[model samples]
Target: SALNLQLMSLTLFDVFGAALGVFVVLTVCKFVEEELSNINMPEMKGKEGRFQYTITDVKITELNLTHADLQFIPEVGLLFDVQNSSITLSFHRRILYWFFYDTGNINASAEGVNINTILNLIRDDDGRLKINNITCDARIDKMKAQFSGTLGRVYDFLASFLTSGMRFLLNQRICPALNHAALVHVNSMLETIPVRTEVDQYIGIDYSLIDDPVVTSRSLDMNFRGMFFDLSHQNDTLVNYAVDPVIREYDRMVYLALSEFFFDSGMFSYFTAGIFQMDIVNEKMPKDLEMLLRTTYFGAIMMLNPALVEAPLSLQLAVNSPPKTSIKTSGATVVMTAIVKVMVLPPGQPPVQLSSMTMVYTHIHTSFFYFFRILLDFFDSNIFKIFSNQSALESLALIPLQAPLKTMLQMSVVPLINNWTKRGVQIPLADGMDFIEEVVEYHNGFIVIGANLHFSKGLREMISVMPPPHMAVYVEPTEALPYDSDITD
Candidate 1:
């Protein structure tokens, strides 16, 4: 029980500049700037002696994230430092000048923004990424305003008082807006990661976190359930009985290690759901193979039906059990037991079985390393190219169907399985995040995938150009932006 039975481990290595920076500069960080821009500042009202006035319709009209940097706080979470940003806003000003009332519009602008946020990350009770709390500190450096619509000279006199009040009120709204977005909106996005979800009608996957993520000075490590279930039979789950997958290398942006349990569970689910069965008809089979099938089953067909001898041949294959995945330093192998049936179908009649054969189809699973399969050799069906150092399959089938059956499997059933697996499984990722530069390394009983992470365009594209990560730019909590950080930043 004390052993670390981690089936899958995901790591964000210590030096997370590219993807993380891009994400901060593109998605979440960009979202922060937007939250600041969309801030709904409260109205400002004051009375100077007999002159009283109110500033309403207070809203930011423009903002820019000139320069932003993200840093880890060791024991804490992330610190988003938003620097020198440009912001602009507009408001409706109504003044009661000793009973003589007048209304006008005041457009305000500020330069050199100052905002910092701390986001605390933790695993929730349900095993999803959760934001514990968010602390935001924000302000506007220097704000100025222009008045119009009936207040010419009077607007000049009240500019200092009016701008100061608007700037302070706007500053007060910044933290709440940013904090709400992180705790509510951004957390909602993280929640999109499936804890346990149906992959397809036949099977389901559980990517629930095994424990709280380990945050250290070097990296962030997360362990996951990495299990699957047969949807047809809810309890048809493969035990997490494989060796723990270990991640020793932290050279990439993301490092993923999956135990045999992660892959075996899926194979088991499909097998239990009866999805590992396929019927290859002559139409999809090659001409030469179809001819060989016809000749090979001719005698059996004659014995079954005297008049219906020219029926089209069909090869049905079903994996008899869940595939066993074995991984070693040399490579990995998928050992499977399958029953293949040779049949002939008359025009409208049901399939008439000719000869039933058991194929221990063993071929190298590409993902688990280059070890071979089990059904191919046991069925006396010698197919698939042998890899370096692996033993060759000894052909022992005297039925003169080994080569043809091999061809038939490759041509028809293989594609079917590929399509089925494509739709029934996924690599457990949320929207816009993808795995890249993936390198699969096989160990004793598990696989480690070293990869770089890629995040897509954030927010939307704008025509404005942004400086580099180190180059201080500008940020404002004022309005909508016209720049796409993913473009040039």
Candidate 2:
């Protein structure tokens, strides 16, 4: 869709080097360890005059990635340096002679191994991240081969040759194992980022990337199609009329900016899905409110029929249009326009509409945005304005209904909408990571959210292998950014 192209100017995430460093320490290291756990090594055979032996069923069963460091290579890519790792393998060794032969299992291990690799990052055609190239160098400091059989002593005599040849073979496999992990497993993990996912029954959200990530000395900027769509009508998109949100600071782990369209589209989806409507009748309506409704519509009920006077009263509220949001440096203001229809339902008959009035709901968030709220006359002037009849006399008669109707909406309708929104929409993030200490600031036509990140697990939970001494990570304390700085009304 052209939605990404249209909203390409808006940034979705401004990830700093600090956040990326945590991700590498928490996720990539453990993942690579798991991916390189098992590697089958080719068989080796050697003959020298009367002494001959063949190694079969060779496999590296244990791998421990002890240390990993990531560095940015300016315009090139990321350099991955791994140190002090170890690999253990099991194999069947057979000794053959002119007339005598012996067979036994042997365990071999190599420690103090180091792997250096460069990972080239790129954006694929599908707008997903890809590692286009990987160049790896491996080094093994020491290798040990333990042999056991009836002729264990004889095998020990040739340990140097056995360990040397096997070390070379093991060195050959390191790059391929790392290559598979980066290109296949690591890239597969990136696919979990949501492109089009249903947030609830009525609406869906798109976190699809708009363009390739921009890498700089301090941060990585990514643009996305941050739009919500109606489930029943997926093709509809609210055009982004608001100014693009700007990222001014690079102090936090990440900064997320949302223009007004980011929120308007969510309201549009709910409106289009018919979720912005409610019907209150019978026990749901308060006794005093019902008394007011009956008293106000007494003349209309009498005109319809004397029997209709005892009919049950119903208050129906429906949003007339999509809600609009305004953002300023202080905070945000959300305004919604809805129409309320007063009606009555009689036994074995269709409900009859008695009267309808348009109501605008506005909530002031802060003093700075409160001033601009007055500037939008089209939204502010209609606050509680009511229209009941064509004649001036009929309009005067409906004056009693005005205050009560608005009060009922403020009490019931607003909370009903809030309860639905409280369920919270699912964000597009890798499992176990969540945002914390979020601070919102309003700008003209847009909003920004600056927040740090946290993981559900500590260092032990983050990795299956033993904890590394270099990084003993614990939960980060909540640290909010400066107020009056971010996104969404």
Candidate 3:
């Protein structure tokens, strides 16, 4: 009986404790709900009349409230504890209010006012705004108003700093490297030379001939002299005689001899035969040669003219002349003698028989010689040494600068701006606190980097609506009211 009584008492005590706990929970929940209701109710008569309220915290038990109650609770805050709660009804009301009330009035009154004007009006004096723009209906306005004051300025500043840094890095490093690569490729192409070749056929001959002696035995001698020769043989008589005719005749013979010697030795004859052969072989050859010679000869001429070679016919005639000689014989014995002569032809002016040939050869040779001379001078001069040193210095400068610049641009500048822009972030006002923490982070502290970015599409849209700097605006803030009626009536 004692054991049963003790067990029954323990059970009753446990049941009472459970009941007390439930009562306390219910009382606390009621108090919290009442407090939230009062805080969320707007004062329609005061200066805060235009302001709305949002609830950030509530117990999970109150999630089943109607749409009217949910309007004052932020969707994120409402769903904090409650699962499967309907937050869509509250969001739709907020969007509807934004379109009908705020947007409609701004559009009707400000004829020329665009999205930018609204943005500017709402922005703080320092150009910072916590909630840039709202896009919800009346039910969600309470949540939107919670962000209205100036709490989001910090995030905006952070995003702007990162974006500016990104742009700076790209300009400093990436652009230069790309430009250098292109320049290097162009220089390499310019330094190379294309190759070409030409072939030509040259023919030459050497000949020797021996003469047979057949008419050596049949020879006779005869002598004759002028009758005036004995009188002219006296020294005084010969001195008195006029010798101008003989002198003139002797000069003519000497001139003839010189001409014959040049022709036989293949000097003038070689040049003449070349022109004749070129004219016969191909009409084009002479014209082309003439044009080349003219161009080259317009400059300076050189010493050696390689183009003037003896023709085959001229060579044959020269060889034949050596063997066949005219001889005067007295009786059976024969007198023999041989005379040999050589002729030289130097490069000359135009209109000369071999002018084109000489000029062409001289010009080509001179150009080659000039080029070699310049090359030698370059190696010998101080300028060449300076150029070599400068080239080395330039390469050294470029190599070190290139890597750092590329790193800063791609890792910091480009990523910061591009990522933030992609995420729809806005530029913060210049209030001296643009640098935000953890906006950008790097891995290996060297190669790869990461960034956190936020973007404002509304801000971008507003900026686009504004006209360029050249345009001016005319407005009067103190204009008289159109309605004179008193509202108290």
| Top-TM-score candidate index | 2
> Each candidate: what lDDT?
0.67, 0.67, 0.19
Q: Is candidate 1 or candidate 2 better by TM-score?
A: 2
Model 3 has an lDDT value of: 0.19
> What's the lDDT of the predicted structure labeled candidate 2?
0.67
In Å, residue 44's CA in model 1 sits off its true spot by 2.0
Q: Distance from true position, residue 449, model 2, in Å?
A: 4.4
Model 1 clash number: 25
How much does each candidate deviate from the true structure in C-alpha RMSD?
9.8, 12.6, 46.4
Cand. 3 TM to true fold:
0.13
Estimate, for each residue in 6-30, the C-alpha lDDT of model 3 and write its tens digit.
0000000111123332332333233
User: For model 3, what is the alpha-carbon lDDT of residue 377?
Assistant: 9
| Candidate 1, 1-489: lDDT as tens digits | 312368788887754376554654556566666777677666667666567778788777777777777666677877778889878888898888865888988887887788889888888887887788888888787777887876557657677666666666666677877776666665666666678888777777777786777776667788987777887787656666787777888667678787777767778887898878977775675788766655553454455676557777776778878888777777667677777666778788887866666776665544532221111111122333211111222223324666656666766677677665644345666666676667777788877877776666453221012222223233435532212223110
Point out the higher-scoring one by lDDT: 1 or 3: 1
